[model samples]
Target: MEKSNANPSIECTVTECEYHCQDQQYCSLDSIRVGTHEQNPTQKSCTDCESFELKKSY
Candidate 1:
């Protein structure tokens, strides 16, 4: 498997989106998956994320 950047800023969301924030900040977790909203129909909407105004987590 390809190694991902350990930097928290690189990941803007959580692995399971139930904890997603308005600013895009997420809690620390083992791993995360990314895809286009179209690909993952259940993906959280980050258009107006509050995390943008708050803080970012890895």
Candidate 2:
């Protein structure tokens, strides 16, 4: 896999995300899209990372 520069401002722990920096607990993208699944979301669990993409296995 190719190494990616981690965005210092964006810390992440989802290793399954394609945009996650392979060498660090951070995201490589310049920005990310966050959304909510519920119409009246009121908690952290209701939120979702819309930018998430499954990492392709080779």
Candidate 3:
């Protein structure tokens, strides 16, 4: 498959995630959905990556 040149990049330190490309801190997915755990999120911790998938194998 041809890699999309326009893939939006976001720094990801969660190496345990499946979308995290090996050796790189960038997310491999084309898009991600960010959602807050609470209705009134005031901190970055409140945000969650709904698109995050636990890596079955690393």
Candidate 4:
């Protein structure tokens, strides 16, 4: 999947975190897994992400 050059126009509260989507659909940040936050299943907020890493395009 390629990184999206198309701006999602969405701003995430996780300021220090970098995020990229796979095929421009799903966030591909390997630093944290999606299902890890079982307590807050509906919580998509990345503000609490401690291991967030940015994805670079080649």
lDDT against the true structure, per candidate, is: 0.40, 0.86, 0.74, 0.43
Q: What clash pairs does model 1 have?
A: 22-49, 22-50, 22-51, 23-50, 23-51, 23-52, 24-51
- Name the runs in model 2 displaced over 4 angstroms: 1-3
Q: How many residue pairs clash in each candidate?
A: 7, 0, 0, 0
Q: What's the residue-level lDDT of 15 in candidate 2? A: 91
Better of 1 and 3 by TM-score: 3
**What is the lDDT, from 0 to 100, of the residue 53 in candidate 4?**
63
2-58: candidate 1 lDDT, tens digit per residue: 123243554555443333433545433344444443543653563333323222244
User: Candidate 3 — which pairs collide?
Assistant: none
Worst 10 residues of 4 by lDDT: 9-18
For model 2, where is the 10-residue window of minimal lDDT? 1-10
Worst 10 residues of 1 by lDDT: 47-56
1-58, model 3: which lDDT tens digit per residue?
A: 1222223467777778777765766777788899998989999999999988888775
Candidate 2's displacement at residue 1, Å, is 11
Model 4 global lDDT (CA atoms, 0 to 1): 0.43
How do all the candidates rank in terms of TM-score, highest first?
2, 3, 4, 1
Model 1 stretches astray by more than 4 angstroms: 1-26, 39-58
